[model samples]
Target: MGRKWHGQFEGEVVTDHAEYPLRGRLPGCRIKHRMKRNWLKMYDKAGWILRVETVINDPEEFRVRRRVRRRGRRRTEWVPLRKSVAYLFRYRDVSLQSNAQYLNALAQVEDPTAGLRGLDTITTRKRSTKALNPVARPDCQLFTALMSGEYAVHGFANRDLRSKLAATVVRLNDDPRRQSAQVSRLLHRLHVYGLVAKIPRSRRWRVTAFGQRIMSTSVKLRQWQFPANWPSCMTPSKLVRKNRRPNEGRSYAPFSGGPSTSPLRLVTPAIACATNSKLL
Candidate 1:
């Protein structure tokens, strides 16, 4: 008997001797009849007997298999390639380093506070003034004008109120434009704080009720008093004369001598000569 391997199948076996050909070698003679009988008995006992057919000349057979491959490992380096490239490009030449140092020195020599003084100091002062009391600050003159009856009808138009205030202050002093800018800045602050509202369809603005209250408080806090040197347009001649009759013996007119009697004279000859000359 040849060595039997696991899962190997023999040729088909026939149970009926009449179905087999009476040749020298039968087609199913190679299979072990005893093993086939035992397998059929086991199948009957397990109730798994199945009718099966084998195709001897079938086509379309294929085989499939799976395989895994290992990959090569990589090396580790302490220094990075990108850092080396950056260093090379940055320090490529001596001139570049010299120029960089020169630029740094120039930056140091330049007026560092040139731009910052106006921006930082002036801004801080303005903010401090506004915080102390918004309406009291000259910067808030636009809001002040709005609070006052000066621009009540005009409203807060595009810098119109500021221009008017500038003109007024200039008429009073000098360099009104600078004062006007300060007023505009204050008005912007008031608008940001929601104390003022812009009128729709126009550049004019107005103070809210809260603004009015703040203005009233500011007026009280500042205790504004009329300047001693304030000028007035009234003249002595235009001064109103009181319509009062002299008291009993008091005289109404300036004291002068008593009224004098004088004869009325007329130049008739000269008048007649002038009339004759005009006619001629």
Candidate 2:
């Protein structure tokens, strides 16, 4: 008989070659072979090997897909649940806060009076609204110019203030022309507020002490509230005097023409008469 492989066998020991064939291995060998064959068939049918390979190649892709599926399921499950209009308005308040921060920064550098201008842009019907009443245009612009000390008198005459404010509005919304109108209105309002004083003879303006105080307070408040990560754009004031003369240039010139001697010593009348007769 051939040597049998060493392993535990269940049930009766066989002695007859005709019943068990000692040299032909075990009877249940076929069963074990069938089990392995069935396992491989199931594995092939499931394509588990390919699935594992795809997962290994790009794990994040699968994770993203899974997240999307989860979100989709949650959306379907929770969309029916609704919130109050007041809650929605809260978001609007947050948006307004962000806008306020931007406007405040612009006021420090561009124009504090821009708020008045923004208010003027809204329709008259909307004038009573909280957002519309926050600030005036001229005030914002004047404050910005004062803080930055960058205002040009020429700009006021040419309506460049409106242009600058229009550009700012364009960054936030469409229809810049409408924004310009609003800026003009705001400037007019500033005249009402007495924060901005317009020179009648020329298209120029100067900020009042009250306006300066307001701007200072606004800047301090904004700095405390927003705490921007960027550095401030403010510059120190410089003392400038045009056509300044140096000490040496200011010194008086010495008395012109050489020193004088006392009336050319005598020979006075006599010398004068003799010289005159000789010439004749």
Stretches off by above 4 angstroms in model 1 are: 1-143, 167-184, 224-280
Please give the distance, in angstroms, between residue 125's alpha carbon in candidate 1 and its true position after superposition: 12
Error of 2 at 239 (Å): 50
- Segments of candidate 2 deviating more than 4 angstroms: 1-146, 152-158, 167-180, 225-280
- Name the 10 consecutive residues with the lowest summed lDDT in model 2: 50-59
Q: Candidate 2 lDDT, tens digit per residue, 98-130?
A: 345534543588554665553344323334332
Residue by residue across 95-202, what tens digits does model 1's lDDT show?
Answer: 244345534544688675544442342234343344423434553453455676865666666456655665343232345666566656656766655567778887
